[model samples]
Structure formats: C-alpha cells, structure tokens
Target: MTVLKAADELEEIVARVGPTAARLLTRGEEETMPEIAEALGMTEKAARARPTHYEHLDS
Candidate 1:
C-alpha cells in the first residue's frame, strides 16, 4: 500500500470519526495513542490533532 502523509492521515481519521466522535473514542484512552499514531504513520502530535483523535503521548 502507498504511504500517506501526516496531513492526509489526519484528514482521513477526522473524516472517519469526525472531531467530536474521535474525542469520544479517545477520552481517557491514553494507552492506545502510540499504537494508533504509528498505524496512521503519524507522530503522536499530529494524530491527536485529528478532530477527536488521541490527545498526546506526553499527556
């Protein structure tokens, strides 16, 4: 499969879950961010910013 850019991955996540929905999925779920971010080929930072995606590794 072709690799995706960070911005593109971010967009995809938001498109799938929406900002609000993504947050609901991630709330209090800090343990899952690293795996999800890696799966999306993004740093923890970019992934967290995708609408309601995980917040951050440093949090």
Candidate 2:
C-alpha cells in the first residue's frame, strides 16, 4: 500500500481537497469529527464524508 507521508502526496491532497480539508484529514485524527468540521469550516456531515470520498485515491 502507498503511504502518504511525503510532501508531494500531501500537496496532491491539498490540490484535490483544499488546504484546510487536506490538513484536517491528514493531521486532525486526534480531533473529533465536530472539531474537524469546525476547523475545516465545514458541516459535520461534510467532514465525516471527506475520508470515504478521498480514501479511494490512495489505492
């Protein structure tokens, strides 16, 4: 499996999801979904949906 640990991988995520969402998705695992939503300036549902939506790209 490809691990997204490099800057270019993160930059790709940033390009696809915007900096806030990409940062939140990648670095905000300790935070709750509500907190992630707040940090990303999105609704909780949107925050929850982000992973499933983008996870396929990793494969």
Model 2, span 1-59: residue lDDT tens: 35656877887865566644544566656467788789889998887778766655544
Model 2 lowest lDDT segment of ten:
14-23
User: lDDT (0-100) at residue 5 of candidate 2?
Assistant: 60
Distance from true location, Cα of 9 in model 2, Å = 8.7
Using all chains and alpha carbons, the TM-scores for the candidates as numbered come to: 0.47, 0.48
Over 4 Å off, model 1 = 1-20, 52-59
For candidate 1, report its TM-score. 0.47
Question: lDDT tens string, model 1, 1-59?
Answer: 34568778877675655645666647755887787789989998887776433333223
**Predicted model with the maximum lDDT:** 2
Per-candidate local distance difference test = 0.65, 0.68
Query: With candidate 2 superimposed using the best TM-score fit, by how many Å does residue 7's alpha carbon deviate from the native?
Result: 14
